[model samples]
Target: MAHFRQFAFKQFGYFDFYHNLPNQLAQQDYKSFVKIVFLKAGGHVVVDFQEYQLEQDALFFINAGQYYRFDTSCIGTLLYYNRDFYCVEIHDKEVACDGILFHNVYEIPVIFMEPATSDIMQGILREIKIELAQEDSGLEEMLRILLKQLIIRATRIWKHTHQVDNEDIRQEVEFSRTFSQLVEWHYTRFHTVAEYAELLHITPKALNKRITRYSQTTPNEVIKSRIMLEAKRLLAHTPLSVKEIGYKLGYDDSSYFIRLFTKQAGASPQFFRQQYQQA
Candidate 1:
């Protein structure tokens, strides 16, 4: 087995990446780490895979391990920092948010910060950049402070924009979040809606109905999607054989796995892996 090094933020490390992303919509894929885009000026940004849209003055968050594309011709500053950058010890419990706990594609939480809040965030980012560029010995201390400030700001913004107080939406979001977490933990073994329903303390029928109502998709579809996503990730990033990957994901029969992959991804596992490699 091969071990991958975990990503971490280090003291005295300068982390900064800025791109004036060109116009002309293009598809992009990410492997790990989330990105927070504060659209300074842009026509419209589309998260192709999710069918989510963001216009000017809207903030968007993308989780690691999801494939996405952006529209052509938008001018904005992109912040590409690892989640580890914000993991600092603080006295105030409220100063730290559980941003690092979420590591799934559907776990991405996005909120549009108000104009005043956005300006404040941009200013903090600017200060971080300035501090990173400096050669001072205490630069790491300054960067850590700035990163904590940014996380706190984001939490406040999310709290303000959160629409969960609407009971219907709240239930929907909670159910969806719980379902997602369950899938992440058990995708390799439990592949049935009834199994998940039992774990969630809901009837299978009720679970299906709630899933369909909230996501406009059946629980079975959601399960299959999660399975397929794991398959894709393994195929694209690891040197695992199709049979091995299928078996690892709970498909004992490789032929059945190929058929399922074809049904969900419109291609065979080998073909999909080859295509991804070629790209």
Candidate 2:
């Protein structure tokens, strides 16, 4: 069985990159993580399966469990840290940053800061680099302190820059958050949209309407996408056979599972597994 765990900062590691290459190298699928990137100097970058032309001062935050790849040619400083390092319990008690509280855990809210804002962030990054490089007593404690400060500043910047728009959008965001949490808890046993709706104490039609309004897709599509994502992960990372994988994902009929996988993934389960192996 697959289990999800929260990220903690004390167990976190840091990687700083300042390289320029031509071809892309790393394509990762993270299960649960968070990354904060400060583009000290860069031309073009790709994240979350999309390419963005980055300015020297671009700042971005990425949440866990997202699939991402990057173009190696871009030269920049990136801070790759996991959510486990943040220690959610500690953060909830100690930090009161709206951006970190609302955005960082679930979605990657990338905010483009102005020049003055960039200066403040760069200063924090410089301190973090120093802290990471030195061998000192209570290093983890220092890092956690720096991370909290960073989150506080970033959240302030985010709130100042991007104002909330509408009440409907807020409701949609809440619904999406609830829906994602439910999916995380009950995905294996409850495969249908109606199952999720019943758990949330709402009709399937209402659930579908809200999901469609928020995501531009129906509830069934969201369920299928989450299932397909897990299927791909298991197919790529594990040696389980197609039938076993299907059964693990709550499908009893292997043939029906194969058809559904094919419909959504554009390939049969066997073929998908083979392709991942080849890659």
Candidate 3:
């Protein structure tokens, strides 16, 4: 039994409400929409080839343009929406989630919820489903409110978990978010810590210290990881040759790119592509 329901307005956007996770999610790519998944049970989600096992109640936030798939299906509630619908003309401001929840590359995107928090979030999801069940004129606005509520609560939870209470800590968080946004915008062009540090008006050493203080990896590692993730995605999904992929990723020297990718990924590009194809 597939428990999938959807509501869409051709002018606005589309929303999917899932009582149970569907396997089709593995096959379909929603490159233009952001996604939130609240899993009630055990499952696995793969984001950019990194697999996360969900042993308990958890929430996942996936930004648009990233390659993701449900490796194991579980009973869950999912919300998918693009910016055009959520940030329509009538809205004065877009949801604050674009930076913290969806685009913060330093933090792992999954939130493992306690039972109390899970119940609260589940209630919001229930209201969304209820709103979707109706076809009234106010349905779009009501659904928008519900979705914004969900994002706001999730952002609060994320801030609480990361302890962004103090001014110093908040400033650090802001730096990290800006760094992430910069990296997202320029990873294809700027591949060095010094480049990003210059953009942040800080030294590479200072940038690394700030990033490593809050996150697990160094600034250089984060940039490399983002580039390698894109390389892996293109290799697995596209028919581009190794040299073509390397050039696309701003690497003119194919041999150097191959060596760097092998060192970082522990396999040659061709081997990795073949493995994904066989799988």
Candidate 4:
């Protein structure tokens, strides 16, 4: 990590890495801290065995223990922090990225940016870079505030992009947001549209309509996607066998789980694991 970027350490375990990152990220031992990378210009990043090509400015919020390899041509800002310094979970209400961005393993690790938002993000990153440069005793609090603002802004963009209808953005945003939360909470035990609909205080029909409208996917798709995302993560990160992984995801019949995963990911669980491990 030290070889990858110029770093600054502030109060109480605060650490930030800002660099004009090269095309290929150097692989050292994996890290135990979370990473918030603000990428601009043009490049690619591979995270959790998935590759993303960034043609525009992007924000990548990655949790601790995830693996990432960046394109050598990548150029932008990178910030790293651990629970000891500042925990996003403790400040969830203030920053609000606990589910949607940071702790979310289902969502992609990239947020493609619009120009206006990109300008603001770039400005904020520049300010952070400048603030960390001097011997300012008050840098911690200022950086915390700035980091919170950045997370809120990034969450806004994330919700807007994932929302089906931006016309009544607020209401629909809440609807979709609550739906996602429900999925995260009960996805393991509850897998039906009607069950989730009941929890959301809406009809199954209304749930599907909102999900399809904003997410461009059916309720069943979201359920399956969440289940499959977890299954994939387990397969990639754990030594669990295919049958064992399936059972953990609540599949009584291992064959059914294998079929579902193959259909969605275009490969068998074992095959996907092999490919990922070899990568």
- Those runs of model 1 whose alpha carbons end farther than 4 Å from true positions after fitting are 1-14, 20-118, 127-165
Across residues 9-62, which tens digit of lDDT does each residue of candidate 4 receive?
422222233343542234333366667887775777887667887888898887
Model 3, span 166-225: residue lDDT tens: 988888888888898899889889999999999989999999999888778888888988
The candidate that achieves the highest lDDT relative to the unseen native structure = 3
Counting clashing residue pairs in each candidate, in order, gives: 5, 8, 0, 7
Q: Which stretches of candidate 3 lie over 4 Å from their true place?
A: 1-22, 26-29, 87-97
TM-score of each: 0.64, 0.68, 0.86, 0.74
Ranking by lDDT: 3, 4, 2, 1
Give model 2's TM-score versus the native structure. Answer: 0.68
Model 2, residue pairs in steric clash: 7-83, 7-84, 8-84, 8-85, 9-84, 9-85, 9-86, 33-64
Error of 1 at 170 (Å): 2.0
TM-score of 4: 0.74
**Highest TM-score, which number?**
3
Query: Judged by lDDT against the true structure, how good is candidate 4?
Result: 0.71
Tell me which residue pairs clash in candidate 3: none
